[model samples]
Target: MRTAKDRLRHTILFELLGLVTVTPLAALILNKDMGRIGALAVAISLLAMATNYVFNLAFDHALVRMGRPVNVRPPWMRALHAVLFEATLMLITLPIVAWWLNMSLWQALATDVGFALFYLAYAYVYNWAYDRVFPMPSAVRIKAADR
Candidate 1:
């Protein structure tokens, strides 16, 4: 499990990197001014920061409760994690995206889906790398046999 400080650091880094990479690209792709796109991206990033911290913490806890190994994420687990995270964020951000961009709901859905796809991959790779760089705490649990 990550300490609060560690989770904060991860959230900040994730949003910062995501903003830097995605904001400009979204602007160009959507034919919107950078300011509008940047504002929207930053706003969503803020929401995502909160989401990321809570979601990751809850996710790890869920894994542990299910008797799964933390930090040693199998590929399938990583995929599921990424998909679920993106889905959660998509639901939270859809209305915001529609309102911010003055877009129709369907348009917002399309645009948000694009963002979700990018983030789904980004979350997977970023987490894999982050875990390698700042590995999760080793478990305190011992097998019943060992006990």
Candidate 2:
């Protein structure tokens, strides 16, 4: 339901803020160099940015078809969706992250989980703030409700 420009803004802001937060935290937590953490974070952020665009588009389309509005997802549904999405993304990113950082696969998995937890919370808060700060236009909201 978001315009392309809005979605682009979301992607950029999400990644930028995430990089700012995650790099330092990852370095501190994992006892890695800042350069390593920053590189890994950037790689993951790029992958996530692409995935975010596709996943959101699909999710919105499904919601519309299911007569579900965008504002509130059921708690259980959100939990399941978030966990599944993170898990799938971790699988895709873990190897690259580990290889880049010269870590074992298990280490990578654990590290990825740590980041995922952070992002899960970040995404929830970010989206809540995003909606409040840049709410859907009144016309679109009315049209969506009428449907």
Candidate 3:
């Protein structure tokens, strides 16, 4: 398991990197002013940051409870993790996106789906890289024991 401080760092880095990459792309793709898209992105990012922190901590704890190694996830588990995270986030963001963009529920669902797809992919890759770069302490112990 990771410390609270480590999880905070992870959430911050993930949000910052995501905002930097996604904001411009969203603005360009939506043909909206950057300010509007940027504001929406920032709002969503704040919500996501909170969700990311809580969700990841809970997820790691759940894994430990189930006798699974947090950092030694298989691809299927990784996919499930990303899907679950995005699904939760989508439920929370749908109405917000609809209000912000002045779109119908269906339109917002479509837009939210687009964002979810991006995050689904992003979360998977980011987690894979994050785990490799900063293996959990338990993972480190397990790896050392194997040697």
Candidate 4:
């Protein structure tokens, strides 16, 4: 498990890097103004940062209870979770994204999917690197075991 401060760092770094990389690409691919794309990206990133905290806390708690924590998530489970999360996010942001870009709902949906794909990959890589760089504290391991 990560400390709150560490998690905040992770969220900030992840979103910052993502915004730098994705905003331009999104603008080009979606043929939208950079300001629109960048604004949307910032809003989405902030929301995702909040969601990241909640989701990871919940997942860690569940894993501790399960006892077999910290390994590769099953492919099916990963896919399911990713799809559900993306769909929920799409619902929340579609109207905003659409209105911002002056696009239709379907256009927004497609754009959202593109962004989701980028994030899905970014998440996997970020987490892998984060674990390597800042692993769970031994205290957390001990706590997990005691639970």
Score every model by TM-score.
Answer: 0.92, 0.86, 0.91, 0.81
Write the residue-wise lDDT of candidate 1 on 1-147 in tens digits: 678999998899889999999999899999999999999999999999999888988998787778777767898999998998899999999999999999999999999999899998888889888888988777746457733
Q: Find the 10 residues in a row with the least total lDDT in model 4.
A: 138-147
* Error of model 4, residue 117, in angstroms: 1.0
Candidate 1 displacement at residue 56 in angstroms: 0.9
RMSD of 2: 3.3
Off by over 4 Å in 4: 70-85, 138-147
What are the candidates' C-alpha RMSDs?
A: 3.2, 3.3, 4.5, 3.0
Q: Rank the candidates by lDDT, best first.
A: 1, 3, 2, 4
Writing each residue's lDDT as its tens digit, candidate 4 over 1-147 gives 667898888778878998899989988997878997888889888887788777766766776678645444555655555566566667778888888778899988888888888877777676668667877665546454455
Error of model 2, residue 89, in angstroms: 1.9
Please write out the lDDT profile of model 3 over residues 1-76, one tens digit for every residue.
7878889888898998999999999888778889998999999999999999999888876876676777678999
lDDT winner among the candidates? 1
Off by over 4 Å in 3: 139-147
lDDT of 2 by residue, 1-147 (tens): 689999989889989998999899989998989997898888888998898888887877777678677666555666665676677788889889889988899988888888899888787777768877988654435375546
What TM value does model 4 have? Answer: 0.81
Error of 3 at 31 (Å): 1.2
Q: What is the lDDT of residue 134 in candidate 2?
A: 80
TM-score of 2: 0.86
- lDDT accuracy of residue 89 in candidate 4: 66
Off by over 4 Å in 2: 72-81, 138-147
